[model samples]
Target: MKKLIPISIAILFIAVIILFVMQCNVSKECAAPAGKAETPAIRADGTDLTIAYINTDTLLLNYQLSRDLNEELLKKQEDARTNLNQEARAFESEMQEFQRKLENNGFLSRDRAEREQQRLINREQELKDLNAKLSNELMVRQQEISSQLLDSITIYLKEMNLDKDYDLILSTTVGGTILHAKDGLNITGEVLDALNNRYKKKK
Candidate 1:
């Protein structure tokens, strides 16, 4: 579960980048701005297309909603682990008692002893199943949280661009497809601040 968090976050970043790219493609705004010899298309008014990027790693670290969601996930993982451990310990204690009884011939008959052993086996299987179920539930929950975060960011970006200020908004991460970008075009701080403000209001 601990390992899953970083993997999930990486996937989230990739998903966000894909979402933005799809939007740019749909709007036919993915082409390079004019003045470049290889430019594919230019605005009718001949103005340079505005572009901005958000550092997804930075956003995930500073965004209040993201931090809150991550903490929620950690809490859930911890709870599930603690519960499983308690059940396992209880089961072990019962098994030890059963072993002691069998060794001392405490059961009235062989059939009774066999029944107790079978019941323990069944209980072990039940515990295994429960562990698997909890893991699956946590995975599903992580995915839901990721989707929610992506949607929130997408909607905010769309709203921020309502004025058509940026023709393209890109998502960047450490060692991502975007290797280098001008600091001037980085809007991560602005975006993170707004997102945190909006999340606070919602809370």
Candidate 2:
């Protein structure tokens, strides 16, 4: 089975960016003269209230860091599955041997047979415990990678806006609140290029 990172984390990342922009919007609003009327679609700087949005889905699909992290996570998952399968196969082979011994009356007495049965039971429990542990470890590792990606994206946005002076930046996802937007307002391609470039530099 293919495991995936939780969608809520991605949503939360977008929410944080939106919240920051909202705060900036409020600041802009408050900065105006108290008695002054609000304008429809322009800022005080004579700019068109520079706004752009990122398509989160496209961003994740194209972002180098996200791609790398996903590949790493997938490798870890495959490794865990392979290790577990090996252990399970070994356990199954032992169980088969035990069953053959019982069929041939290889045990010296009932007590010996009972002890063998108990050992098999204990081994099964051990396998179950190991499987759970591996799953949990993978989940934790995935979450850590997700957090790192989110941090990287957030930092990049801050740096990009340092000179761009965007009045507002938004994130949009498929089936999200953003129902319609102009093609010119989509900046996913630009963000993806920047992310890949940054990742290449770090690499």
Model 1, residue 127: C-alpha shift (Å): 0.4
After superposition, the stretches of candidate 1 with alpha carbons farther than 4 Å from their true spots are: 1-19, 22-47
lDDT of 2 by residue, 146-190 (tens): 678678887888888887767777887787767898998888898
lDDT (C-alpha) at residue 202 in model 1:
96
Cα lDDT over the full model 1: 0.75
lDDT of 1 by residue, 102-175 (tens): 88989999999999999999999988888888788778878878888888888899888876567777887778
Error of 1 at 196 (Å): 0.9
- Scanning candidate 2 in windows of ten residues, the lowest lDDT window is 1-10
Model 2, residue 23: distance off in Å is 6.0
Q: Which residue window of length 10 is worst by lDDT in model 1?
A: 1-10
Candidate 2 error regions (>4 Å): 1-49
lDDT of each: 0.75, 0.73
